[model samples]
Target: MSIETWLAFFVACWLISLSPGAGAVASMASGMNYGFARGYWNALGLQLALVLQIVIVAAGVGALLATSALAFALIKWFGVLYLLYLAIRQWRAPAQTMTLEHRPIGRPLSLVLRGFVINFSNPKAIIFILAVLPQFLDPGRPMLMQYLIMAVTMVAVDLVVMAGYTGLAAKALRLLNSPQQQRLLNRSFGVMFGVAAGLLATVRRV
Candidate 1:
């Protein structure tokens, strides 16, 4: 990829990372539950899924997925169901003030797995990657190098964006001193998750 092409892709990466989606909701939810230090593991899982998506697209499997209506519908319904599950979990989450001394710190691996599932189930992400990433490619150049550059750029930008989301939620945790306040926050996040699921359900193959 040329410098100009890479720069444009870089900007696109930032925009994609900044967009509100299940990934952002997952990051904020983790941060609210576990704090920044522990919750950041979720972001790592998101990057792993992202890398896999890029690899799939670069290998031309994304084209197959794009063409397969059955495959797309299956993945889309899975994503929708998973988000609904998350919403219910969030709604039923215990409302209690989190403190360093008494906070329930979730296993990092579990958090990572949760994040991975959240991103991986979203067929829209892979479809979006398939649609957008190829625009930056140069047919005359080696394809692998361009994909590698894009994968790295996307992961790095997303990490930073997720960190900000996580940190902001963690900071907000401090203000939620009462159970009532915490309960309200939890339900609000539950609503957001439900909204995300509804939006994902509406996505169609482009």
Candidate 2:
């Protein structure tokens, strides 16, 4: 890719990372419950999922999945169900001060898996990759190298953006000192998760 092309793709990546979605909700919720240092696991998991999605796109599986109505529907519904489950858990979460000592989000493995599933199951991501990635590709150049560059750019941008979201939420955790305020914050995040799930469910194949 030429410098101009790479620059354009880089800009697109930042814009993509900035777009609000279920992944952002998950990051903020995790950060709200867990401090930024620990909450970072969720961000890491999300970047991993982003890598997988990029690989799927590069391998052409994304095109197949995008074209397959049944497959797309199945994945979409599973993502919606999983987000709804997260919403329920968040709603019922006990009020507690944010502390690295009291980690209620679950084991590191669970948190990572939760983050992975949040993005991996979203068909919209696969579809977006199928639709958008090719626009930045150079057929005459090495496909794998180009894909790698694109993936790295996306992961780097998203990691920074997600960390910022997590940080802000974690900072808010300090101000929510009272039990009532904590409960309200938890419930608000729960509602955001539920709303994201609903938005995912309503996504149409186009």
Models, CA RMSD each: 0.9, 1.4
Best by TM-score: 1
Displacement of residue 12 (Cα, Å) in model 2 is 0.6
lDDT of 1 by residue, 1-206 (tens): 99999999999999989989999999999998889999999999999899998998999999999888999999989989989999999999988876655566889999898888889888888899999998999999999999999999999999999999999998887777788888898898899999999999998987
Which digits, one per residue and each the tens of the lDDT, describe model 2 over residues 1-206? 88899999999998999999999999999887877877878988898898999999888899899899999999999999999999999999988665545545546677788899999999999899889889999999999999999998899999999999999988886676577887898899899999999999999998
Error of 1 at 152 (Å): 0.3
Q: Where is the poorest 10-residue window by lDDT in model 1? A: 97-106
Q: Compute the lDDT for candidate 2.
A: 0.88
